[model samples]
Target chain A: MDIKEFVAQSIGQWRSQRSAHHLAFGHFEAIRSEIAIEVVADHDPAVIELCKAHDIDPGSAVAPFRMRWEGQSDWDEEEEVKGTCILVPVPDPGQANRGKLLRDRGYAETMAAAGDYYLTADGTFVLTTAYDRAAAEEKIWFINPNVRCRVSLIKTSAGSGVVTASFSSEIRQEIRQEIRQAS
Target chain B: MDIKEFVAQSIGQWRSQRSAHHLAFGHFEAIRSEIAIEVVADHDPAVIELCKAHDIDPGSAVAPFRMRWEGQSDWDEEEEVKGTCILVPVPDPGQANRGKLLRDRGYAETMAAAGDYYLTADGTFVLTTAYDRAAAEEKIWFINPNVRCRVSLIKTSAGSGVVTASFSSEIRQEIRQEIRQAS
Candidate 1:
């Protein structure tokens, strides 16, 4: 599948259960979160700004979207995990399955980041991003239409040591809008 | 389950289908192989020698086994991928689910290597090894008694760049031995 189709299939609300291992600290943490992915208009301010920041033409953006997440982590029960990021995908003209993923908030860090992304033959989405202090590799695959799996690694800047590795299983929480007719 | 139990469950022949992406070259390769896992006796010479190489007591090794693989990669159809390796699992005395895994042949590099291994709450086995030129992260989990999944990453020594990332789906090829009484 191309990036647009992959993004379209992923548009929904999801209940995510994640387990993370901190190798440096030898700690295991559990997180439960709700994530929402919504499509963004190409002319949206966030999408336009993100494209400009990466020096990519706004017209080249395909299936731009915004993701918002809220969760609770066992590491610190008092602190809530919540954030949102705008993502814009620009497909390579030469390779249909490969492209750049521009993000307003990075996975390993909160800074703006652009990651290289590609789809495997089996339609698995793989993304890798390098940040100032760390790098992140993420893989996402669908087990079925409603269930998906994600694996992520946060490595040291040099990529020698992995500080954190995590696996998450997400189940889609489809929102069925109900219509009321005037009686 | 502990390391021993995990090893026991994995002792069998498997048909593995793997897809690997070499990020450096932006190439994708598919490999199909048959793998055999056989139990090794505690007194086996290879097990003893591997433990000694890692400076671990032979008696501490639990459920040692040898793995043999024969495969064909799409990248090189003429070159057959075939090899064998001895694996010795030495459980940590204090932690039941964590331990050291001594390997006769490393994943990223063909040299004797030791890796830290742990079983997650869901019984997924994760192993991380650091070799001279690269580091490897591997994760294996049983989807069912007859099916399993493996994910592996070979990264640069500094961990900044992922040279290769692979996903393998292994289906157990159970060997059923039959006994016939003398007629």
Candidate 2:
């Protein structure tokens, strides 16, 4: 399944299983414009209580890991991620027994209300791109929080699965340094 | 008309109207993917002469102005784009002209061939928004890259009218910069 599908099911299961609370974007529009959320004292209580409620360890639940690209890495093995890089903790999607915990705590109702919420491999929030340009032979897609991808899609047979994942052979250069770092 | 209608007509009259260069991207598949061009070098003489040959005055041509958002801005004006803002530039229909110019000069048939071919805004670039949360809604509906935008299409009791010509919104934020710059 594509990203949106993973959110509605997989993301929720992980959140509750880890006994963590998060502010869900749900199906909030993240296409062209933006809206911001701040993490402040107000957010601490919910997070702390959730941490305490769950017997699972919280320290190792999330951390930043750099993705190594193919070929010689531009970075030294311990280089501090050249340029700017963003690191945020993400609850693992592979959480154990997350579903039952949600049900027992009556969080199922809340989870159901939140259309769906999944994170990418690097904890990036995502949404599909929209809009097209015939003159440019281009299709545009969207990911949340300061990211938009304008790439080309190839029509190749991927066995028999009806999936549409695009690649940017002509990607003209540089996404966010943070994302580039993470990617 | 809206972006689609504007694009079709621009393609029809691009060369006739002296637009020496153009670029565009259409919905390539079921999944919306975008392929766009970026100028690796803006001062290439052969390419610039071709631009001039098409009556595409590099000075008045919509290139620099259109790509303003995609490149770095020096915070000349200190207005902040609140929240998790993401800027996605719509592929203007004018990309066709850029390709045609290259073809006329036999510089390159497709951007892939030239390696140096870049996207210069032929007309207006539109920015659409999908909110992740809520805030003031200010959207710029500019379109038609190869030529100038008369007025964006607006439906009213008096049939329809073009949107007023407004330059691209001037606010630039550091965190929400374009992944690619036209330079």
Docking class of 1: incorrect
* Model 1 Cα lDDT, one tens digit per residue, B82-158: 99999999999878899999999987777889999988765778898989888887878764565556877776687
**Looking at every candidate separately, what fraction of the true A–B Cα contacts under 8 Å does it contain?**
0.00, 0.00
TM-score of 1: 0.53
Candidate 1 per-residue lDDT over residues A55-104, each given as its tens digit: 99999889999999999987899999999999998999877799999999
Q: What does the lDDT come to for candidate 1?
A: 0.78
lDDT of 2 by residue, B32-101 (tens): 1111223323454544554565555543223211111122112322442221111111222455322221
Worst 10 residues of 2 chain A by lDDT: A12-21
lDDT of 2 at A180: 33
Please list the residue runs of candidate 1 whose C-alpha ends up more than 4 Å from where it truly belongs after superposition: A174-183, B1-183
Worst 10 residues of 2 chain B by lDDT: B14-23
